[model samples]
Target: MCTRYRVGASGKKLAERYGAVEAACDAPGVEAFPKRRGWAVCAVKGELRLGTMGWGFPPPPNGRAPVVNVRNLASPFWRDALARPAQRCLVPVTEFCEWEGEAGRKRDRWFSVPSLEIFSFAGIWRQTAAGPVYAFLTCAPNALVAPVHPKAMPVILHPEDEARWLSGNIAEVLPLAAPFPSQLMALAE
Candidate 1:
């Protein structure tokens, strides 16, 4: 549901929720065809660096629709992604935008860090022929996100899960498939 996000390392930006910052998001580049954009940490081009990644992983191998989301419930890459080493990534944003209120026409609201400066949204990534495309992982929506964009929650990683998510087995990382604490989330006007 969160397609737009603000990327930065400042505690003031993400609401002081994010702890470590190995790398900040790479600003979008100017190109005729731009890659999907979001904060990420993955082995792109054989390098594990934190930066903004394109939303869609790539033109699918099976000619599937654009893989913009790493949906655990439906993404074909779910099993593969979970099995892949350290597919975990994060999104640090000042505000996440979403539409709400109606079934046909909705209004967008800007959600920012309430008590902290910045926070990381749960995500996953995979290297593609074009580059490293990311699919922000999602689970069942919580009470907070339900009213706004009711579908799923990002794969928020706990501080303890960071190391393991970046190195542990699929079984080990599966437990992180939940929404972040509601206390840490706030809807932006």
Candidate 2:
């Protein structure tokens, strides 16, 4: 579900890479955890801007848990965000971790796109009562992530698709929710 990931670069570097204006905020650190603030590039007033947003949405009415990895686009909870380009965001990431092994013995397995020093996940953000929060989409795992996290993997966007994800209509961006190419990804030792 990508509960944890690494940014691995300064805010200035990330903003530069995404062609966004940097916000005056503290760095989110190398490793990011759920509910913590992390850097996200969002379109504001038709301009891409980089800023920090808390991970995960506020708990739903049923009080299940904070929504993190969004997989169901048809759900009422996520539909509005999916239909609006302004709510779409780019989650900067260097590497993401998935746990392997049994409950007590599980160990983290990190994966990264070998060709990108920094890549982005297809994300969505919203203004909640607690403030702005963000979550990335997930899809069925690929050959590389399936062994470690068979259920799902974050939707890592290709550099070319980043713009489409942020501005394209639902029809244009929905197809991008598929898994990234396994051959282009590397599992860290």
Candidate 3:
């Protein structure tokens, strides 16, 4: 479900790559974990802005767990954020990790897009009492990730589709909720 990921670039590098202006906080460290702060690229007015946000959404009223990955866009809980352009965001990531092997012998398997040092995951964000929180969408795993994590993988966006994911309507952006091509991705040694 992409509970852990890495963003190796600094704020300046992220801003340059995304053509965004640095906003409130510096970029996150190489590794990002749930409930911690991470960098996200958001569209403000006509400009792109890079800022920090917590990684998980607050727990719902039923006392469920905090949401770190969004899989059901049609759910009422996430529909509002998915339908609004302002709530959409880009989660800059260098690599993502999934646990492999048996229950006690699980090991982290890192994956990345070989063609791009940094890529964006289709994300959504909203403000809560604690602070602003963000979560990225997940889809069926691709060939590369299926063996390690058969359930799902983050919905990674190509550089050319970053802007579209931020500004496009639900109808236009929903199609991007598919797995990235396996040929473009590699396993980190």
What does candidate 1's lDDT look like per residue over 1-189, in tens digits? 555555545323332343333454545522202245655555434445555567766655776556655665445546776677666666554456667887777787666556645555556677767666676666776677777778865655555665566677777777777877766777765
TM-scores of all models? 0.72, 0.98, 0.97
lDDT digits (tens) for residues 1-189 of candidate 2 = 789999999988898899899988888879999889999999888789999999998766996778889988778889999999999999999999999999999999999998999999999999978889999999999999999999999999999999999999999999999999999999998
Locate the minimum summed-lDDT window of 10 residues in model 2: 58-67
- After superposing candidate 1 on the true structure, give the runs of residues whose Cα lies further than 4 Å from its correct spot: 8-26, 29-35, 43-48, 59-65, 73-76, 113-115
Better of 2 and 3 by TM-score: 2
Please identify which of the two predictions, 1 or 3, would achieve the higher TM-score against the true structure: 3
Instruction: Give the runs in model 2 whose Cα sits over 4 Å from its true position.
Output: none
Candidate 3 residue pairs in clash (backbone atoms < 3 Å): none
Candidate lDDT (C-alpha), each: 0.59, 0.94, 0.93
- Report the error of model 3 at residue 168, Å: 0.6
For model 3, give the 10-residue run with minimal summed lDDT: 21-30
Candidate 3: segments with Cα more than 4 A from true spot: none
Q: In angstroms, give how far residue 110 of model 3 lies from its true place.
A: 0.4
